[model samples]
Target chain A: MSTVKITEEQLQLVEKLGLVFEGPGLQPAAARVAALLVVSDTLELTFDDIREILNLSKSATSNAINLLLNVHRIEYITKPGDRKRYFRSNLARWKNVMKEKFMDLEKTNSVLKEVVDQRTPATKEFNQSLEEMVSLMRFMNQQIPRLFKEWEKSKS
Target chain B: MSTVKITEEQLQLVEKLGLVFEGPGLQPAAARVAALLVVSDTLELTFDDIREILNLSKSATSNAINLLLNVHRIEYITKPGDRKRYFRSNLARWKNVMKEKFMDLEKTNSVLKEVVDQRTPATKEFNQSLEEMVSLMRFMNQQIPRLFKEWEKSKS
Candidate 1:
């Protein structure tokens, strides 16, 4: 296992970025989890290492890990000989993360579509605007996967 | 102004979608500000109205509004006779919002580049991964602007 000591400056920035873990709300526990993920690439820290360093309860750490996993921001792997799960940032393969985000955006557009569909005729103009927003979101979602595939091909 | 009452269920769903104002993470104040922008289209609301509805302090609300304005998510338009700054969401046009977000993503990729460049050779593999991440982000940034242009043309 690598012993990459995180500097104070890097730790501060990681915590600030953690504020973006879920969306706009900054939860300290979430931030701590995010910071660990950010440093994980270099540190190669196991779950035990992270728990000890952050002083987080096992369940709390598990929950944070789960959230990051849900977002495709981090991944867990087991070493060949070790049973302990090791977590690392998935930044190297961010295509999956972008794809997930675009899917969420598409879902939001669907919600807007429902709003537009349910509105009265008096607000037809507003409903048209919402429809346009949905179209824009959908268009982006369709294009992203293709773009990423092409990018990956080009890199290879 | 159309009085479209958002149901509690709808609000709860939006909150889960990271649309309604929660507080800062990946779903930044931008998503909430964007939500308010959409909601504003159906119901004319002042800055105070927005602040109250989102349960945000004046400064936080102002900062979010400023970001929305910068991103062209919301527009500042004055009434014919009123000097008060009236803000409205631009649901009909989202090309500008896509453009702004792409720009922000590019800026973040640049920062990531600096971090990767400054890292030690011992962590060279990790640094390479970071560079790949930066490349992917830059590609997305480049693709989005072109996609928006095509979208705008299609709409016209």
Candidate 2:
């Protein structure tokens, strides 16, 4: 329902960003839909509006939107007195996404821990390196949340 | 030549981890070689040794090792009186890799800034949200290096 017109170049940028998202595990269509929604003028668009603008089939749009919703990438908002649901990029959830990415360091740390536990090599330098990697991940794990808190404080 | 023999289970884990690395950007062969090098007992394996153990073809192993080296994922160490070069996980370079990943947030912020500038929307909430995303990225950009330094201090 947003009346603001999006330019062709902007649409191309969205298309390119769609691929970037795809690198992070999003399906092609879902990435495109998310990109389109993020760049939308109102940052919220109806299903029909998105489908038309993206030139996607109804099923594709529905599937893409649903995938995004499931992943908390996009969320739906219902307007009072309007039966249609409008979807927008869940910008708030981006912090969560970033937090999840930072958590990957923890995953790598755990994997390394398991490897070291199993190996138990006598090489002091190798063990030191492994422990250092684990410690760095732990430190990052501790710090990432604090960074989020700092951002929250600054926002206020 | 590392004297410690790698077990079958360890090799299987390396195979699994290769797929994980491939998800990020590395090709399959390169990811496998990287994982194999990471899990090596001495953390340093020569090209021929890696190819023989991983059962990779000469060109395949060479290409994979070269790719990993180019990306700073692995590094070579030359032993005195040995013509063969030993390759190992570049733990020191991982900080660089992490810094690069953190810098991606800046790229996203810049893209979002450009989009907002071009849009110039009247919606206060949308603009505010975009600015907030940019600010969070800026905050992270500043904090990531400090976190790295903290790790270095902890190491010393």
Candidate 3:
């Protein structure tokens, strides 16, 4: 049995950090699980460890775990000797998550451009604004790669 | 009565753009309303016009419009001699909405910093990654203003 005791401070940290993830579209329970994984001293927690620590019901924990795993936010590894699966936050993947979001914007921008194209020239002012918005999204998408490159350079 | 006839293409535009807004946390109905306001040739819609065109229930349309207004995604204008207020997309404010979203991260980061401070030194590797994530967010926040400035210069 893994010998990790849940701390009150750690539990509070889960709740605090949980709300942050929730705002970005994560389910509340899943966000809390994500927070627990990221901020815990152990860095990895078994299924029961998370459920007991967070006081989540079996189904809630199961659903939350599945959701996180499916989203690539959390990942699991099996122990060499035991059949138990240990779950850990894919903290390293956060930057990739943000990048994927911008990549998703390309499809949306394409549709926005299409909307702009089909609109009657009578709505010239509105079309100009929409065009500006699309250009801004494109500008930011272009900037993200450069920005991350800048971050990597500065970090080294 | 204003003479804005609903078209099939416009309905599809709403569905397409609605999904885009839904991704970033807007409710489906509200997202549809936002899409309609932005893409429609008229640039604005009356409450009844929106309700009829979208086939949304009275309450659904009302709730959707209210949500958009509360978020500053849409605004109302009154004609000089008419009492009926006209609803229009505040498309220009979309960039501001994205900016406010990042601005919200400042508060989230403060709590994250606290989590880092309270963690045991033993979790050095995990702590380092969390610190990096925090620094990245801070870097992006700092970069956004300069990025926007560069966009303005390029636009002109």
Candidate 4:
């Protein structure tokens, strides 16, 4: 078993981020996964090493790791001669994630606009309000690609 | 009373966004506020107009409006003959709100990093992982100003 000890202070910090350590849901496990990723960014621990240190069952650990990966919050790297896959968080991929999230929000906003359009309002004012939100979100969505492009340029 | 008939589809859309039509938490209030902003943007509804439609007590609606204002999720405007404040969601302003949320996330990530740094046996791999998250968040934060500038330029 790995002898790495998690401190109370560390746990507190993790908890502040809405991560539960010993909670009744996937939240705690998720938080631990995030904490592990944060630590792993500065350490050289493999999956086995991390699982042992956290004292989590293999299945629980794997579930957490899988969730992070699906969100693009964590990534796996394979080292030659080491069959074990090493997991790490990519610090530069959030831009894409944010972009994706914004796009999804825009899509939802569009659907809402259609609903608003179909609803006849006794209040002309209320109808107008819904239309404006649709316009605003659409405008923002239209601007995203340009925003990302400029972001890419500055990074280069 | 503004007879704005919210369609079932529209209600579903709002619910999906976590806007509460019926709930015990601030969530419903928050959702009402958000919906109000959406309406105000297009309909130019005055504060009194919003209160009547949502069926919320004036003070309750006022408080919810204030919360949205503080978050930059909505803005209030005053017009001639309109002693009452008019509220609307500023689409352009949402970029700032999103930026602030990203900064908050970065702060949380940093705190997590500090905790990992103080943990015993300080596995190099774990530390590396934390650093990676911090770096990723940092990069994302850094990209914001440039992205906004580009967005502004493109809009012109």
Number of the predicted model whose DockQ against the real structure is largest: 3
State which candidate has the highest TM-score.
3
Q: After superposition, how far is residue B41 of candidate 1 from its true place, in Å?
A: 10
Candidate 2: tens digits of C-alpha lDDT, residues A1-156: 435467798798788778767867898989998998877666778888888788889999999999999999999899999998999989888878978877876776777777677664676777777677777778888988998998899779
- Model 3, span B1-156: residue lDDT tens: 446876898789889989988988899999999999877888778998898888899899999999999999999998898777799999778889867755776877787888888888998888999899889878887998888889989999
lDDT of 1 by residue, B78-145 (tens): 77887657777775456555456457666556656655655657876777777788788888888888
Q: Could you arrange the candidates by DockQ from highest to lowest?
A: 3, 2, 1, 4
Candidate 2 residues lying further than 4 Å off, grouped into runs, are A1-4, A78-84, B1-4, B78-84
List the candidate 4 regions with Cα displacement exceeding 4 Å.
Answer: A1-4, A16-156, B2-26, B40-42, B57-59, B78-83, B112-122
Cα deviation at B64, candidate 3, in Å, is 2.0
The candidate scoring highest on lDDT is 3
Q: Model 1 RMSD to the real structure?
A: 5.7
Q: Considering only N, C-alpha and C atoms within 3 Å, which residue pairs clash in candidate 2?
A: none
By DockQ thresholds, what CAPRI class is model 4? incorrect
Tens-digit lDDT track of model 4 for B1-156:
654454455445545443422221235766666755553324456666667766679788888878777766677788888586767766556555546544665665566556656655646654554455456556656765665566557655
Report backbone clashes per prediction: 14, 0, 0, 31
**Residue B118 alpha-carbon offset, candidate 2, angstroms:** 2.6
Q: State the lDDT at A82 in candidate 2.
A: 99
Instruction: Give each model a TM-score.
Output: 0.66, 0.87, 0.93, 0.56
Q: iRMS values in order, in angstroms?
A: 4.2, 2.0, 1.6, 6.0
What tens digits encode model 2's per-residue C-alpha lDDT throughout B1-156?
435468898898787767667766799899988888777665788888888888889999999999998998999999999998899988777767867877877777777777677664677787787787878888888988998898788777
Off by over 4 Å in 1: A1-4, A16-26, A40-42, A51-63, A69-72, A77-85, A91-93, A122-127, B1-95
